[model samples]
Target: MTDVQRGTEQASWRTLPGFTTVRTYQPRWLSRDLVAGLVLTTLLVPQGMAYAELAGLPPITGLYTTVLALLGYAVFGPSRVLVLGPDSSLGPMIAATVIPLVTANGDPGRAVAYASMLALMVGAITVLAGIFRLGFVADLLSKPTQLGYMNGLALTILVGQLPKLFGFSVDADNFLDEAAGFFRGLVDGDTVGPALAVGVGSLILILLFQRILPRVPGVLVAVVLAIGCVTLFDLPERGVDVVGPMPEGLPPFVIPSVPLEDFGLLLAGALGIALVSLTDTISTASVFAARRGEEVSADREMVAVGAASIAAGLFQGFPVSTSGSRTAVAAQNGAKTQVTGLVGALAIAALLVFAPGLLRNLPQPTLAAVVIAASLSLADLPGLRRLGRQRRSDFVLALAAFLGVALLGVLPGIGIAVGLSILVVFNRAWRPHQAVLGRSEDLAGYHDLTFHPATTHLPGLVIYRFDAPLFFANARSFRDQVRALAAAEPRPAWILVAAEPITDIDTTAADMLGDLVRGLHEQGIRLVFAELKDPVRRRLDHYELTDTIKPGDFFETIRMAVEAYQASTGRTWERGPGSYEIPD
Candidate 1:
């Protein structure tokens, strides 16, 4: 099909009935959506407060974030079931951004203002990225690297919140000081009384509920039970610190104060925040989209999340992203449209207006327990284990990211992870596997490379495959491989490159291919290509390499190429080619 026709067909398929499987949006679905919203809101309430604490802001700001972000995402987001709110992945990120400019626990108003400005900056960046369709940039961080970074961030957040759980605050700004302070507090052990009891009790209950009945919202249940216990038994009189009264009603829209002197610092911090927000939003959206058998538009999601952040900034909120837990809840509850998120936002709004004080007496330890539980879910132990079993290099990358977050901090950890991922990419490109492939002995009508030591390769006719895109990093290696193979005994007159796996080619690779073609022609050898993608073909054409090689040499399939070459040479083969005479 033509490119325009294919694009039109794909667009039309988007409107088909089974495209999203969200047909029959009846009232029953709405009722289920409302119930799911209430369940998620219960969990979000304490989570918002805890994440706010992690972000170096007052607890009420968490509620403000929850309400505004929920409402914002409901309108613009494409995922009908995705729940957008304050996220644990973004907690340490925000803390890293704001803690440097506004001292922790030092001027609360200035901290909030800086946070709001950060949100605005991040929003603007995301919107611009969406406008320019830069969502492909997120692909820079590989899945393994992202897994490592998230595991590291989870550990940092879990440890950082421990001091609050113990009712005494530490003066640590980053992960190292937080770790040191945690150990110091452990050594003292003098401040451990009602708060410790409440914290430990809440943790056990949450863990138990998670293990015994995962369907139940353990965090929400723990919060309610903890609050009831505190109120019924007067635990606060015995040194247990409660969350205290939260201001009711919505946050009024106001412009954040931006100081000229701190613009550079805030801009750098906002860049980091924008990256984290984009990474987390796309990752979560892709997960849900795959489960629903849908393809997510990365650019569209960027616009949705950008608008959500802008709305959040205007209403005294911080950065927000898609929450995996809440999205799973909505999907499980049979959410059929964006109405599910709308219902969730309305539920939170109603709570903010009428029942803001309901959680006033909620124990700080309980909130900590909830945050810790949520953070633990992001650990990704299975991914770590798979890395260890599959590739040692990936295991090292994961460990480095973990240590970076635990010792250095969130921003540094992300930088290190991205660096490691890039290093891996370069390492592979620099020395890509160029295997001699042929038909598998045991498999029928299929081709495979012989990686085993005992396997033998066919002589004269060389069929080689490179596993990565041809680029500047590996152009020299490609030339070397072709030269070395051409010099081997019983030199092949025909060389077929299995180019199905090569998805891209840079100018350097194109130039190298042209040189290789001329060199092979000098030796009276035919250079052929099979299964080349259209993009690669275009690159070759652009560089005039296609004209250098005969038009008949490019074949759509390896089987076809092999057959054509054998027929052209008038050779009948019982097995693969054994040897051939060099053209003199």
Candidate 2:
């Protein structure tokens, strides 16, 4: 390439967040980033390995995935302090995706290959979604359902880790079976005392340190102490399992070539993974970015996430997502830029290259303890409780989601959450909130008649408000409500609709409106509209329903509509002894 072309390319590279951060790098911030990165690296190693085991992959891939993901996001991601790695939330999901495809023959290598392929596909999906500006896809899972799903997932992970933490393996499928197996084993005196003590002790140490010393790396300290204890006491002789050291070096960069027939299944898994990953990334980006008084472009964040996944996939790693705990750790330690991520990535890489056997004596139960501790953070029981006490419908939705995940499994739980979201939206729009409006003495222009029971009402005018877009599903309800308003005592001369809440009008609704207009005219009653938006007006014109109502029937405000009614009918509303209206 020519020098000018190369310079242009370099200038284009400046669009990347990491490059910009480097070009405008501040020297004073370097020390803080260095220290924060080192601190973050301590959490990354154990959590990465633990989450990998949670995903049913070998421990080493977690470290590999973490290094590559951090490096990749630092280059392309929008948020500077957001950390990416193998997340506990994605662990069961990754296992759900690849284990079915790999477990038949019990080949660990085959599981790795399927997971890598899954990551590549997930990357492709997220990148395309970003390029197309489809960040709204994250809304597929609503807040209540997401809470329910996470609660279910956390419980699942906690239970699954019980066997490992107790120093035994229980062969089971699904949450119930796993729970049953654990309890059955416990009853059978199958728990190894030494392993249980180490695991439970490690768990207690991590949780206590987190609560007592928020700044310390509890997982690192617990791992160190456990390893030392194992080494000093030779705990392996007591049937205690250790993670053993990772492979000496990173896996080679190779495109995972899986059986073509598995593509269909893997693609299904990828879609679910991509959705959860992007939703999580977007939410995290919003939070951490808000802390610094900045906003993150969701599209750019999605692209960055895709790049991270692809980077990890090439190294035979699994799906990864942002870790709120690790990011908080970095920020707490004064991370100033993506350089912290780069520094952390490089430091982990150095460990992999130089001291591959650093964790050789790391007890497997300690790893299980790490996972259990992380899982505890994933649940939000208070949120679930608040939901239950706040709204009955939302509480029902959350309960369904929780049950779906607990009984059905992780992937199906996501499917349930998304489905529930769609249903709730439809239910709201279909029934909606309708109100009859009247002028009250204490209120300003108008108020719901249900609340202002004594408000003044004009003898020949009725004002109605429907708080939803006019769509096919609710057209008939609108028709019936208007007809009921018109049928009330002594009948009305005009029905004036408060159109501000009716944001749009579909063809079916327009047709229904035309019919209502004709019927009102036959009864010598006029139909009128006020505060209709221009877009809805244009839609009415397109539907040709404007031809049904005289051009004079439309008003820009309720005041104007009321004035027109008084001018034509010589009627007015005012506070009186019984009725607020005084007929002229």
Candidate 3:
């Protein structure tokens, strides 16, 4: 190859996230990865099938999604052990999007096509986000809100699947109505006894095995048992619903055939799916990486997951995300590289090609049991308890998200949860805590005077600290607070701002600072900044405020500012009263 062509190829390879890991692969790790992959396959098979049903698609679509998504992620995913697949958390989201557009005639093919389009759109958005290095977009969904959303989602999934578990169905519009309908079914003797027996029995076995023999594939065991009983006894004739025959061979590549009129709804659904999947993937990847003493690049993860989604979409499957449970299973089984994921994908593909009817007798209730088990894990009751004990407001926010999902449908609930999270962020920024700085003999640096009420500030020097960044929302409050402090008894000569926490200074804030500087200067008081970050200082410069405020007014630290004040005035102020050790 020519030199320019070779260099271009190398540069292109450099952009692929997992290329470095693949290049550094060791042969010794292969045996362990292969074993882990085989072990993971047991769980992945049942999970993919179950989640596919949850997504309102044929069980075989789950296998197709599982195969392609794993292969795609293995090629581009950055993490050594993150396993991507059909996720239970995203199943309802897929259903919410595709169910409405499906025709009254119940054309499953068109439904699948629309869902594929949503996945494609989500994949494009995620890829563009990664290319632009907008990984922080995931941070928009805060932990409290995420916990609440997942908890709500768990309840939603559980409630929706309960009727199916009992060999029945509900035609309600919302969660409460559906839940009520399920109860009415039970009261009216509408539930099938055989299906309920299989489902409940399978659920109990799965739960018990999980508790007693954690490493055992309880889901697979339970599913196999259910299938065996149904097949041997001819349970279908006894009013039990089985998955029946799955499509044989590989998934055919199909371009989505959605119309232009429905593009807006699909686009909205794609954004929601992308946000949830991206947030879940990054968070799950980060947790696993941290456990292994490794680092996670969120942008790279977006690329990997986006690639997986696109690959799945191309094969007539819905979106996929990082599976925390499957990845944990892979880790516990000693997964050493992306080869583990590749092996699992190959195993599923082989199953589809060679053993398509293996699970033909698998009861629908058993599948529902599998889904209910997975959904139960995402409940996060302990996390909620922790939040309640540690932070009340956060707990309330989480509760809001839970209620939003439980009361509204999945799509609207996600919108409500995300909106609530953003509002909480804005609320904190709008009314952030500020403090007047004072010194204690026991502590080396300045502390909040409210907590150390007996401590005193240096006379005629007002030291103030704003706990949040200076922005348009809080600028006016900051100005008023500083003005109030200046008007207190024993007027101050200088105001030194401890600005370490003020990481950003927007245009509105800079303008407010300019007005404050002029107002303070008119009253024989000079405004000074200590511990201000370089970037924030540069912003002040851009606003042309640095020219008006002398260069000498800036200090690297609070101590330097204090020393400068002493040097100019020759004052040694007396220390405050409180001298005891502060309790944390």
Q: Pick the candidate with the highest TM-score.
A: 2
Which scores higher on TM-score, 1 or 2? 2
lDDT, candidate 2, 126-170, per-residue tens: 999998999999989899888888899999999999999999998
> Model 1 over residues 1-584: C-alpha lDDT tens digits?
99999888666444332233344466667777777777777777888998898787888898888888877776567677778878888878887878788754579888888888888888888888987999986776777788888888888888887887887667776777887898898788746578887887888888887789766877777888888889888998988888898888879997899788988877876777777778878888989889889889888788778878888899888888778887777677667766766666777778889988888899888878878888888899999999999999888888887888778888888788778888988998888777766554555443444442213334457787878899999988878887777877777878888899899999888888888999899998888999999887877777787568778889999889888887888654446434322212
lDDT of 2: 0.89
Name the regions of candidate 3 deviating beyond 4 angstroms: 1-25, 454-457, 567-570, 575-584
Whole-model lDDT per candidate = 0.79, 0.89, 0.88
Q: Pick out the ten consecutive residues of candidate 2 with the lowest summed lDDT.
A: 575-584
What does the lDDT come to for candidate 3?
0.88
> Measured by TM-score, how close is model 3 to the native structure?
0.94
Model 2, 386: alpha-carbon shift in Å? 1.3
TM-score for each predicted model, relative to the true structure: 0.86, 0.96, 0.94
Count of backbone clashes, every candidate in sequence: 0, 1, 0
